[model samples]
Target: MGVLTGRTALVTGAGRGIGRGIAERLARDGARVAVHYGSREETAKETVAAIEEAGGSAFAIRARLGVPGDAETLWREFDRHADGLDILVNNAGIGTSRPFGEIDEEEYGRLFAVNVKAPHFITQLGAGRLRDGGRIVNISSGLARTAAMPQLMAYAMTKGALDVFTRDLAKVLGPRGITVNSVAPGIVDTDVNADWLRASEEAWQGAAAYSALGRVGTPADIGDVVAFLASPDGRWVTGHWLDATGGSLT
Candidate 1:
């Protein structure tokens, strides 16, 4: 049996990219995963299928975040499949490639709405359903710590808020033996970054050079870090920001 044989995990935005990697990893570790998607139901189904094909358990749930009653809608669907929660991976998010000056009110509002508000309320409502000794892992980014790109200021701000949420939530849920932490990744090659990252050798090398490891990160790298935090091995580590950036900050 794997380390998380009896656990139940919910991974938001598991339809694609980093979230898909995390969902599959958790399932492989023996957790019954709930793959949450915003609009890509088909992609979420693909993630669930991949997990099952690998002898893991997973199901997909659809709920668009950043809207009215989004958290409520998500839990309502969650209740249909599972009775309790053991792990919650808040990995759903959006990035604004727009520069600071060009970001409109609607764009900024949507960023905070989906990245900040959705996760905040999702955790709040999920707290009651999460059993004692459970885990909460927030997928953050390196931009929150370093201003590497000025164009992603708003995106960075959202992650910064999430980091704060991780610290504060960890304390609040400590009594229940729940551990809350943030995992920040740097220059990961996900579908979202495929266009620019694969555009040219120069673009690829430039992104790779940002990390001390001299290579761009993969979704699995971030997934494994999250699996560690979700397992018993990470019991004593809570309320901290983990730099899974391949030494990018260094």
Candidate 2:
């Protein structure tokens, strides 16, 4: 039996990239996964199919995280499909890397709505639904800490907010036996960065160079860390910023 046998997990933004990786990994470890996506019905279905094909249980849920009422819609469908939720991965976020001076009100509003607001309320709703000794992993970025990047001022602000949420929420939910933590990744090679990489090979190379491992990270790397956190091994760990950044901050 897998480590998460009989457990149910809900992973948001699971249509593709890191979210899909986390959903698949959790299912593989014996958790019945609820793959939540926004407007990507086909891609979400594909994730579910892959999990089912691997002899794991999974279902797809649809909700736009950045919009109003999206969190409730997600939790309702999650419980409807998984019967109960034991793990919640707040991985859905959106942002744009623009120069500080180029940032506008509309951009900031949208970025905050998706990156900060959605995860806040989603975790609020999902945490209440979690079983005893449940786990909540918030996906953040390395840029939140290292003041090394200037172009992503607005985007970094959202991640910085997530770091704060992870720390504070852990205390609030500790009494209830729920552990909240953040997994901050660096320069992951996901669809989120595909367009940026396409715009400049030099930029991609620069990203790789930042990592001590001399390579960009893959979604699976982040997924594996999240799985460990959700498993029995990570029970004693809470309210920590687990940097799976390939030593980028070093």
Candidate 3:
């Protein structure tokens, strides 16, 4: 049987890119997946259809995080489709490459609202519904540590906070047999980051060179690591910050 047979997983922001990749992987592993999308209904439905075509069970849900009561609404929608949840991947986030000085207050507020507050409350609600021995994988970024550029101050802060949440929540939920961890990916090539890379091939190559592995990371690279963490093989791992950076830290 698949490691996650009979399990249920909720993947937020799963309409595209890394989130889509992770959701697909979980479904392929025998889990009934709740594919959550913020505002991309078409992409969300497409994700669900793809899973069904692959002979996996999946359903689409819509809830924009960062709004009041959005978390509660999400769980309610999830309950309508599945009896319980075993995995929650907090993959929704928003930020920009503008320098710290250039980012206005409105932009900063929006970034924090989405990047930090959304995940915090989403996990809060998921905790109540997540079954014993559940797993949560928060998608963070390698920039949390390196601060590669001034434009990343706000984004890095949010991810740094998420890492702290991972450590603390692991302790809080440890007694309940739930595993909480963060996966920090480095410079993944996704639609979200495509424009920046396309600005210049040198920019993309520079990011690749930063990694000791000497290549840019794909969404699947991060997805594979997340799938492992959500599987039985990763049961012993919790309260850990996994570095999926292709040796970038080294």
Candidate 4:
């Protein structure tokens, strides 16, 4: 139960959904988790409480990402609680389903800002604080590889960029024993997907049918995969993009 004993983890956007699931799982493994939220203070608190109730240790931190000085503010707050970092999960991001023609520069820019730039600068600024042998897990998406949803071209592009970031960052940090990898999930039954996924019986079943598993994924499905990558078992693996898509891409 304590695979990550004595370690510390920071999960961005962990107020709910996949972020919360990752935070809970890390804590369950005995890591003192820092649950970072942008504006969902209440949900952040709920995540902390849930972890604590499960006999795990966790605290909530807030930083509105995709803004100027966001990385600084996040680290500043993190420093107040921890001296160093053992794991960093860049899970904060926004999703869009607009087609190429319908999308504007502003929308595209915001997508890249939150999904791409935030993780880039977060790692850049916080690299020093990450201890040797630490782990960095970037939450990417299966859309990066397949064009199953043409409407998500911009969103998919952002994830593709993130996968590239993971590869290069792993090389840059490998000398220090840090492992960087991208965990790409296909579709999950999270609040973010609730609107469209649950719109109709057909929509729900269609999403489930995308995966060979023949069911909609849950947050825990992705969280468990990240847990493995974050653990010592993943030490030798770096600069790779893991498919957490339940064979959806296969």
Candidate 5:
């Protein structure tokens, strides 16, 4: 039997890309997963279908983040499918649509609303349902620590806040045996990055060169790391910011 055979997991923004990857991994390890998506019902269904096809179980939930009552709405849907949560992966976030200087107030507010406020409130409201010994994995970005992409300052700012949330939350949730950690990824090959890499082969090569591994990271790479932390073996590690950047930060 899988280590998480009876555990339940919730992965936000799990419709596609890294979020979907994380959800699939948790399900593969035998956890019945809740795949949460903001607007893409099709993508969420695809994620659920993929998991079920692999002999795992999963359900889809929707909540338009950055709006009023997003967290509460998410948990409402989540509660309907599962009684309590054993793992919570806050992976939903919006990208920096343009350079920092060009972004206006509305865009900036939306970014923080979805990227920062949503997860914060989600954890706050959902923690009660998070059984003791649960795991909380926040999907952070390498940009939070490095100024590699100065143009993405606003987005980086949001992730930096998320890192802080991960650190402080671990302490708050520790007594219950819950582990909260940040997984910072660098340039995973996903749709969130398509605009940046689709420019040319030069762009793709440049992104890969940043990693000492000499290849672009994939969603599966990030998924495996999350699965490790969500499993029993990860019980002792908490409040740590894990570098899943494939040596890009080194």
Candidate 6:
């Protein structure tokens, strides 16, 4: 049996991308995963199907974030499937590629709403349901520390806030034996970056060069890191920001 047998995990935005990878990994490790998707219900089902096909347990839950009553709706949906939570991965987020000067009020608000507000409320509401020694992993970005792209200023700011939340929440939840941490990823080769990353060989090489490993990161890379944080082996690690950037900051 896997290390996470008898545990329950909830991975937000698991419909696709890094979230999908995390969900699959946790399921592989023997956790009953709740694949949370906003609007991509079909993709969420696909993730669950793959997990089940591999002899793992998983289910899909639909709840659109960044809107009214999102957290409540999400918990309501979650309650329908599971009774308690063991791991919570807040991986749902959106980015604005526009420059700082070009970003409008609505756009900025939307980014913060989805990236900041949603996770904050979701965790707050979920805390009671989470058992002692539960794990909370927030998916942050390396841009929160380094200004890789000026156009993503607002996006970086949201992640920065998330990092702070990770630190503070860890302290508050420590008494309960719950560990809260953030995992920051660099240039990952996911569908979100597929357009430019696959534009040309040079484009791909340029991105890869940013990492000391000289390779683009995959969804599995981030997923494995997150899985460690969710596992018992990571019990002692908390309130820290893990650089899963493949040494890009080096």
The residue-by-residue lDDT of candidate 4 on 43-122, one tens digit each, is 99999999999999998988999899999999999999999999999999997758988999888888999999999998
For residues 92-133, could you state the per-residue lDDT of candidate 2 as single tens digits? Answer: 888565788898888888899889999998888776678889
Q: Which run of 10 residues does model 5 get worst, by summed lDDT?
A: 95-104
The digit string of per-residue lDDT tens for model 1 on 25-121 reads: 9999999999999998889999999999999999999999999999999999999999999999999999655789899999999999999999999
Worst 10 residues of 6 by lDDT: 95-104
The predicted structure with the larger lDDT, 3 or 5, is 5
Give the per-residue lDDT of model 6 (tens digit) for 10-67.
Answer: 9999989899999999999999999999997789999999999999999999999999
Superposed by TM-score, candidate 6 places the C-alpha of residue 194 at a distance from the truth, in angstroms, of 0.6
Tens-digit lDDT string for candidate 5 (74-164): 9999989999999999999997656866989999999999999999999999999999999999999988887567688889999999999
Give lDDT per model, in order: 0.96, 0.89, 0.89, 0.94, 0.94, 0.95
Candidate 4 lDDT for residue 86: 95
Between candidates 5 and 6, name the one with more favorable lDDT: 6
Can you give the lDDT of residue 192 in candidate 2?
79
Candidate 1 residue pairs in backbone clash: none
State the RMSD for candidate 3: 1.3
Candidate 2 — which pairs collide?
A: none
Model 4, C-alpha of 85: deviation from truth (Å): 0.5
Clashes of each: 0, 0, 0, 0, 0, 0
Clashing pairs in 4: none
Off by over 4 Å in 5: none
On the 0 to 100 scale, the lDDT of residue 205 in model 3 is 90
